[model samples]
Target: MQEAKTILTKFNSPTRFEYIVRQASLESAEAILNLNLGGVYVDYEPRRFHVAGKQLARGVLGGVTVDNLGSSGLELQYEQELKGVVGIQRVELSADGSTIPTEAETIRKAVHGSDLILTIDRALQSQVELELSKTIQEAQAKGGIVIIQKPSTGEILAMASMVTTETGEIVSTSHNRAVTFSYEPASVLKAMTFASVINEGLGVGTSKRDIPDTVILEWENNEGNTETEIWRDEYEYETQEMSIEGILTHSSNTGTIVWAQELGQQKLYDYLRKFGFGQASGLEFPYESQGILHDLNKWDPSNLNTIALGHGISVTPIQLVSAYSAIANDGIFVAPRLVSHIVDPSGNMERLASTPSREVIAASTAHQVADLLTSVVENGTGEKASVNGYKIAAKTGTSWKYFAPEDSYEMPNGQRDPYLDINGQRHYTSTVTGFFPAQKPELSMVVIIDDPAPIEEQFYASHVAAPLFGEIAAWSLRHYQISPFKEVQLSDNNQQAFNGQTIQEGGE
Candidate 1:
């Protein structure tokens, strides 16, 4: 029996066996013998013991499993390949009722499950999660997500999400906030607005607009009564004529609205759709969201203004990041993917083709937009997101959560009025999305911090999300050894350029 156990242990299959116990003690063996002698077991089937245990993606693999099959992740998406087929065995027994080993036959061979290889870089993913966890804790944020992708191939390299529990514990959930949580993107959508303007031949050069600190617009109510509403910027700026680049750098809500108006409602809508907004990202994740791009027919005058400033419309972080990837990849929108390929038990590999690419904007237009984003990190609200040596093209977004009234407002004499205050206590979502090596981006990423507390000055993306982006980007660049700007010989007059340059910067 000991020799048999030793032989079995030596032949144990990592792909098949759940666990194997060797050199069992007499007490343990007696427990099984007692059960057998008690006649509680009708039949002792060795085949049942040989079956494989459920193998699931755990920890860093990061996929969800749900009771509803439709909502499951890769477990359901590739169930046929992952589950594999069960087999049957038949044996001819002698008159003594003992199975004859020589007469045993396998009616069907058990097919092993195919191995799914993802595009995720385990090392980079680890760093992303570590940094994201630290950032969320420092900001006392509810949760956060970070997505790193190869801009050229649209392959996701790292995706990390962390949530704070009510008990004040930070833990990782299967919920991929990057592709599932959709919210008003705030100023980050300014990049898309600018892209739309440039794609339509509207002009890359800045458009002059007189931006005011606040603007009051008159509109007819549903009851046919004239009403007025005020739209104000977060920071009061004097009314002055400024260019499109200037608007983006300053992240002016009034300026973005002006540009959206010039682009017109239908054209802007078209551009949004063209950029893959309001559609599934084709990442093949079960819970991926298409986001909320309001229908054109439902567009109100204010919708255009609000949507332009990234308020009226909502978008998943993946959607926004992929859109920026389009700009980085020279205007071609390539759908991002996770599972790269699958290797079957027979050793055959099936590589997944890249998602269909469509031209959203001209290459020249993309380059122009990339330049504008470079300016954003260098001289704009995203300055904090700048890496020491590498040029990062990024945009920052800070959006207020939409408030829903718990009950209708009562008018004079206890009469209920139709009005409900839509403005609630300020809860903000701060985000930063961009690509590095601005001239030739290899990595495009987005970081989102949801409803950060201790909101004294930490509510803004530049303060919270942008710095997180910088940290993660800096770490990723170092891990991948991504060279920053090419080394150039500094002339005597240009010696200051290399003064503070270091091979390694910005990582613990």
Candidate 2:
């Protein structure tokens, strides 16, 4: 038998090298080269790293892979750890430009990258993604984002986003919209606003005050321009006399604004900062948005009232979820985290330290806020989000989608929400966020449904996002096998205890 080989083409470039070698009469030309038959051998180059879990959380687990060339999501945050240092070598060649028959001196050995153990629960993420896609489809919505986190540690278990494109195709966007997409977060923000008031000792949970449905506000700006605007609730009604709990329970816009003013702008701004708004999420995920936070100096006359109703400001889903997580964690704000551990090439595992955390409010204050949120779910707008046997503490937000030019969420006029066109038809972003079990919470979540088809009186988050939150929360409870009938006593410990239950404490 005769065998022949030919170099059909040779190519080289700064980024790569290629040789089109053709081999005839061989079962495996590449294998033969690798076999090093006779005195010949093939010098192969090191391989580039590839990513895993592409089928699930592809956008979140993005890294250097044949599938994704650029750094994104978790890959972007842990690039250096995932991609080891390149190796270097020193070798001598003969006069003929061939390597001498001697071992090459290694100038620098390659260091393998650490393997990342993420906080994501594969099964839960899969389920959340499916449900989010289904919810968007059923609502005839533009897109949606859902996130599940361990409130105590701020570990994200599942984060998913899906969009139905203009062409009517369901697709996961190139970016992790959960961390990247920012919008007016509407009524869910009411909880945070009220939280500020309660934490500052300006008002207690049971404090009562009259809240109006509409208010004409006027103020001067840093630009020395006097602005006059009218801020109103989604519905028309007379002034409401209620306590802080009743206000949040009914999702009263005026109620929140009234208290915010009582807390004062500086304190409101300071508390919002403590809640993780307008700041990096610390995950350092690629292209994470800090959302739109206007400086206190930039506040117009109506900025407070408008923002209280979830306009004139924007927030990423991540920032919003982390804020809720703080309340769930007994007022401790734990920075959200993705990677949980790193394993070296030698198989030695090193657990990463927990993310940065600080107490943003007193435990009693957090308890009061959680109780109020629990009431929202039990008797108010978030009633639809209630799951059987679970005391879910959550709030629903329904806000119009600000239709404007690129990077233009600012409502300078602050007189009218630009979310509606000339015809009075509107686009909406609906959201529901909070934690489960109310006390001794285990999980926190935020679900946002973007631009759902506005049906009269049905565009509210109570009708859109809350139901979805309930569905997923139910499934998550079953997945984790969290006993619905758990009983733990408060330290006060007596015949009458926390939740009126007396049981032995349990630990994981």
Candidate 3:
């Protein structure tokens, strides 16, 4: 290629350069336009389109056919400083080009349009980001997300995401995992379960309150073994008898499933849909998963049983938080929000409001759920998640991962799908999502750790996920300028004991 000439120009002056828009060669220009170079004026001196001697004519310039794609920041939005001078220097084009100091400086300044204001507290975001980074790295987690939302108003205080860094490079393993990843929320859905069941009049009972150890269903398999599954209310500790409250407190999958079935599939589905289960949160992020909930018309015999207990359906973190907000806001569904307001260039404020959903449960039902959830933390599986001065309610879920062949096991008696938990042996998604100041809630959060390393006999949510919630919640409460309810410090022994309790209770 012949050496190109340099040409000095100004922004939006319609500098003379021509290329057919439909030409495939011009497609590269599209990419350049999309590439955000800090939205600054760049010095353009062509290396390929230059002509001989005193530079080609301006009308039919002999320089690179550069096009001013557009400007960003205040320049484009508020229509400020639409035009700027460009510096041109004749130089040989290398395989790769770099930004000139003056051009780079201009772009950098342009990127910040009169200091963009954010609803999120910078201090909180920074602290949460730092803590999340450490957790993601240390745990070798697949990915993790931390979100703090004001339960009263549905405002997101902070949102941070981090994943494992492979090859020692900080690679964003995935996009925003919170609102995007829609996996089985596991037992975290139990809070909804409890609310719906109680709304239907099933009073809270103990986990070991003599429900039915082994319900022998008529559905049998080839092995001739009766379709009987064992109902063991054992975590890592001694198999303890728990009431309906105890069952949720302990996150007994068996008990939860039983109650879910009693509440009826249709009722459960209605409550779930009301909670925005099979829908979107209406956020601005792209590719937000809507979550899966098989239509009720196609319900199977085990559908209600499984779903009642938080299986067979899927949800995103934002969806979960928004649903939980119903309880926090006294049964009224306040849509979760990120952007507080969008301002025009002329200082005009346009509020970006979150769409509100109708109240799903009665305000009384919401208070009941909040109270029960508080018990889950005060006297249940979520005990590890407690903050001394503040009242918090939460639940832990450990899901079993089902793959191909092993997913279906046919026995003469019953069909069994054996999976494990965070402990490498076998299990499903283990997670914990909850809110704090239970009586009068303020912040709501969810923590999902795909497969945590097993701490003791069981891979429990309280053992792994709850502490993470506690840490994040405490940090967030302080960061948001919310007065600390009280100081909470877990002794090494007490924390270990709580972890051990969770492990022992993992089998309910």
Candidate 4:
């Protein structure tokens, strides 16, 4: 009825929609064949949803596309573009169910699925996956994710994830964590506040303030009761006057909150949403998370000062990267994309529309914030993330993993992890995100390490995520041949790239 059928063609549907159940359970099949009840035999249908066999990328590839051909989902990413119109056929069949080609004539030809030209670099994706897996093993942590993007074009070159399954297996996750997973982003979000403050002309990167050891956050709760929360630095510190750059470089929780209070609630919240928090990143991936952003009226004390310190708010890795990408792209927030374009059957390629982009901050403000972040890598908490000659603009974040359920974090298998913070919960997400060669940004990357070991030390973003960021960024710089700036200061631990080889000057 829909046409496009080949009348005499002896072929199956070319949609690639329903792949065969290649990895069926051998046990079930054997049982079915050997079934015997004395002189009588009976057979039963196997379980509807059980796949058994080795999968090359059981998790990684499982999350790809829609249906049995590769994955399982009704709404696959760009399914319409991928699933070409099916060609129809009308052919006579004998009693044996064989097609009678002699009695049939061609009606229409089936159109094969379109080829998706993705921005993801296969080699880079593999490298990222390897590094993420290695990091998970080395840290002895639960799992992690890494993403690499081009600032100017919003093209995602690579994204990889490994997660702890319900069965406690550390394997590549079936879902793209970059777009789906949301968590408190800690200090990596400080850039947003800084960008806003600078955009509002309230402060500059070098603007100095007398920071205190602690600040009391008092605000009305959802119940209309006045609530008070104390905001303290991760480490003990006396009252000190520090520059805005210093506050971010050191990632001072109290210092950030104190300044964020200046912007007021409405302004701060506005900027947060504008930066793409509490909203889906425009990447438009299937099942993309918008992250948790309460309405302005629904905000509590935590949403204010606490959020300024990168707490209380939830954000996806894609959102965080896109926000930073705006700064790297001269204040333009270009939504990330996986597929570059699509190619039709006739080899005619249909270029996709431009990625959603908007100017989040002025170019000058973004530059100022970028410079501040550069200081972070050069002489702040993100030192481990620095490349010797490349000025890096980045931030380190380590926040207590917020488990909504009291004293329990839910597992994938519908089980709750029965552990509290005091019981070696080790619930912490460490993250680092930045763009390199700060003067002229090229690449933006985000590294997230979930629950690194030794809570007292390795759980810190600097120790876990920063080093990984440096490793991957260093490799990318060399691979992409990105030139470095003048030799002003050389890194100590970061003096080398892949192996013991000294990292030469980028200009070299």
> Which is the leading candidate under TM-score?
2
TM-score of 3: 0.67
Off by more than 4 A, model 4: 1-75, 99-103, 164-170, 219-226, 406-426, 486-508
Give candidate 3's root-mean-square deviation (CA, Å).
13.9
- lDDT of candidates 1 onward, in order: 0.77, 0.81, 0.62, 0.76
Worst 10 residues of 2 by lDDT: 1-10
- Model 2, residue 424: distance off in Å is 7.6
Write model 4 residue lDDT over 415-504, tens digit each, in one string: 666433524364788999999888788899999998877646878899989989998998888878889865444466655544544433
Greater TM-score among 2 and 4 belongs to 2
Instruction: Please report how far candidate 2 places residue 493 from its true position, in Å.
Output: 13
Candidate 2 has an lDDT of 0.81
Q: What is the Cα root-mean-square deviation between model 2 and the actual structure?
A: 6.3
lDDT of 2 by residue, 378-447 (tens): 9999998999987899999887777554323435575444555544456788999999878768899999
TM-score of model 2 vs. true structure? 0.82
Return the TM-score for candidate 1, rounded to 2 decimals: 0.80
Candidate 2 segments whose C-alpha is farther than 4 A from its true place: 1-53, 65-70, 85-111, 220-226, 406-417, 421-425, 485-508
Number of backbone-clashing residue pairs for each candidate, in the order shown: 0, 0, 36, 13
What TM-score would every model get versus the actual structure?
A: 0.80, 0.82, 0.67, 0.80
What lDDT tens digits, residue by residue, belong to model 1 across residues 76-145?
Answer: 5766677566667898866545567785688998787777888878778777877888888899989888
Shift of residue 262 alpha carbon in model 2, Å:
1.2
Q: lDDT, candidate 4, residue 39? A: 23
